[model samples]
Target: MLAVKLPSKETIKVVEEPIPIPAKGEVLIKMKASALCRSDLHRYHGKVLFDETEEEANITPGHEPCGVVEKLGEGVTKVKKGDRVAIYLGLGCGICPDCLRGDVMLCKDFQCIGFQKNGAHADYMTIPEENCLLLPEKMDFITGALSTDVGGTLYTACKRLNLNGTQTAVIIGCGPMGSGGILMAKGFGAKVIAIDLDNKRLELAKELGADYLINPKEEDVLVKIKGITHNTGCDGAIVTAGGSTPLNIALNAIKKRGSVALIAESNKAQIDPSNQFIRTLNTLMGCWYFNRSDWEEIANFIVNHNIQLNKISSDTFSISEAEKAFPLFDSGKTQKVVFTWD
Candidate 1:
């Protein structure tokens, strides 16, 4: 079997590896589609922030993977062979309280698939049966792969904010996650303002139903958002791009008591609680992966509203072309790049 490996910075190597057999409580997935995410870029650059050792660099870099179950191990009853499923990124101790409740990402012993173990940027990968969610038959492989991460994460964030028709939301960044945020927010009936420096992504958001689009470089983001909200500020904001500027803009653009969800992977923000936080009584939170209920809701919403996940997809490549795929994705010139197998 051929698999993807990142042995050094800005490089993807396609290597021959033995096809993994399913272990007890696990199943072997025949790779179908594996979407590239911003998180994977960390591994592409040889940075493994999640684990203790540099040895974690050896893991294949892809977390948004979905495929058909090729084989099931003993004790694996959650899914059977030939079932199409999307692999949940987190692997956790099943008995833990968080795991039992389906918030496996919060488990103390959590291991992220792409960072801590071999992932789906390959011919085949094996994961615990409990981590495989059944993909809807109406969903294609590309959409199913994205539903596990970009769509799932944003959908979870929108759920937390309780966004609705009477409110307005400003989504910063307009990358895949930010774009997904726009879709989910609109699906929930909120008037969405899509913000990004990238015109292509902003255009995609417009087609996805964002009521307003702002490029911070072209127009003052705060001014435009305030004007759109009639100086009261938006009801909510989501920052999907890292940078103190976007986060601060989100904090300043929402109305009093408004909620801001931070999903970006940045820790360098300098915020003053006394001035920016306490006065408005605004709620700010860092959000990540979704719980099982949130995933189910996202799936239902996509089916019900006829959300087109592939609208954000840029291109597809085969496992053998991963060498070309990673650098293209790394360039920031494309969106939702994925690897597909026949």
Candidate 2:
């Protein structure tokens, strides 16, 4: 089997490794497609630390993945061989308080597939049965791969904000997660605003049904949003960008008593208490990994065609080309980049 490994920052190597054998209650998947996400870039640049030794030891790098079950280990009965599936990268201890309460992402023993364990940026990977979700018969691999992370993130954000038709929403970044947030907000019938520094991404948001697109470089985001909402401002805002500037923009654009969902990964961010208090920001929700409910809802949305995952995928790369894929993603030139074994 072949796998893409990160030996250190800005370095990727494709190495041949022995095929993995699934343990009890686990299954081996022959990967068809896997998306390279911003989180992967964070891991690559040594920004989001999973293990201090990850930088020194070679580790597989991927999470958003879709595949077909090639083999099943003892005690695995939920999915059979040849079943098309999407791997839920986050693995939680099922008996933990958080998992028992159905909030698996909050499990104290949480171990993510691509981060703490072996991931899908390879020809084959092994995952626990609880972490695999069967894909619809007609769903393609690319979209299925993305549903594991990006789609689930949007679902979590929407649920946290309690988005509805009467509310006005804004997504502070127009990357994959931000774009997914826009689509989800539109589905809820909320007036949606997509903000980004890149005009191209903003345009993509408009195509995805965003009512307003604001590039902070060209226009005052707060003023434009206020003008659009009749001086009321957005009812809810999701800060999907990790940087400080986008976070501040979200804070400024949100209406009083509005919710601000922070879905992006950042090492450090500063917020002024006065600004938060004056705006009456209702919540600052953290959306890192998805719970089982979030994954199921996202799966339903994809099956019902409420969200278009294919359109948001900007590029695809082969597993052997992992070295090239990381740099392209870092360059900010693509939206969703998938690495395929097929």
Candidate 3:
């Protein structure tokens, strides 16, 4: 089998490796589709997020993986051979209360697959049977891979915001996650306004059915959003870009009593509690991964609405082309990039 390994900053190498064997209560998956996430960029630069004692970078970097089960180890009964599945990124202690509830990411001892362990970007990998979600028959590998993070996170946010046709929403980022949010907001009938600094992404947002597009670099975001809402304000906003500016924009642009979901992670921000939040009764939430139950709903929605998951990913490379794929994704010239194999 062949796999990708990042040994240093901005470097990717493909190496030959033996296929992994499943352990008790685990299943061996033959890789099919795996998408590159923005977080993976941190790994590319040799910044280790999970392990501190390790001297060299060794983990394969892909968390969004969809593949087919090839072998089932002892105690694995949830799925069988030949089953198509999407691997949940979180790996929590099985006995923990949060793990029992299927919110593995909440476990105090949880480990992210691509961060803490050898992940996809390999020809074969092993995971506990419990972490695999059965993919719908009609869903392709690309959509299956995306549903875990891109679709799941946005769907969870939409649920939190109570998005509907009667409301107007703003999405502050035109990356893959933001684009996915636009599709979800539109599917739920909300009028979506997408904001970004990049024109290419803004154009993609427009094509994805965003009612309006705003480039903050070119115009005052507050003025544009207010004008679009007829001097009122949006019913809700989602900030997917990591920064204080996007956070500030989301805070001031929504209508009174409206909600804002911050899906991005950032350390610095400016906010006025007395005026921008308290006076307006604004509801701001920090959203992370979705609940286990959200998977089925998200997949069904994608199928029923004919949401084109493939549109979010602009390019796909075989396992041998892993080196070429990373640089393209790193350049920010593409939305979602993936690796696939027969």
- Estimate every model's Cα lDDT from 0 to 1: 0.87, 0.83, 0.89
lDDT at residue 3 of model 3 (Cα atoms):
85
Mind sharing the TM-score for model 2?
A: 0.94
RMSD, each candidate, Å? Answer: 1.2, 1.9, 1.4
Mind giving the per-residue lDDT tens digits that candidate 2 earns over 71-189? Answer: 99999989999999998777787898888766776877777777788889999999999888888777788888877788877877887888888988989988888888887778767
Model 2 Cα shift for residue 194 (angstroms): 0.9
State residue 92's C-alpha deviation in candidate 3, in Å.
0.5
Instruction: Please give the RMSD of candidate 1 to the true structure.
Output: 1.2
lDDT of 3 by residue, 21-133 (tens): 89999999998999999888888987767553463357777889999999999988899999999999998887889988878888989888877877898999999998888
lDDT of 1 by residue, 218-300 (tens): 99988898899999999899999898889999999999999999999996988878767899899998898888656667787
TM-scores, all candidates, are 0.97, 0.94, 0.97
At residue 250, what lDDT does model 1 achieve? 93
Ranking by TM-score: 1, 3, 2
- Residue-pair clashes per candidate, as listed? 0, 0, 1
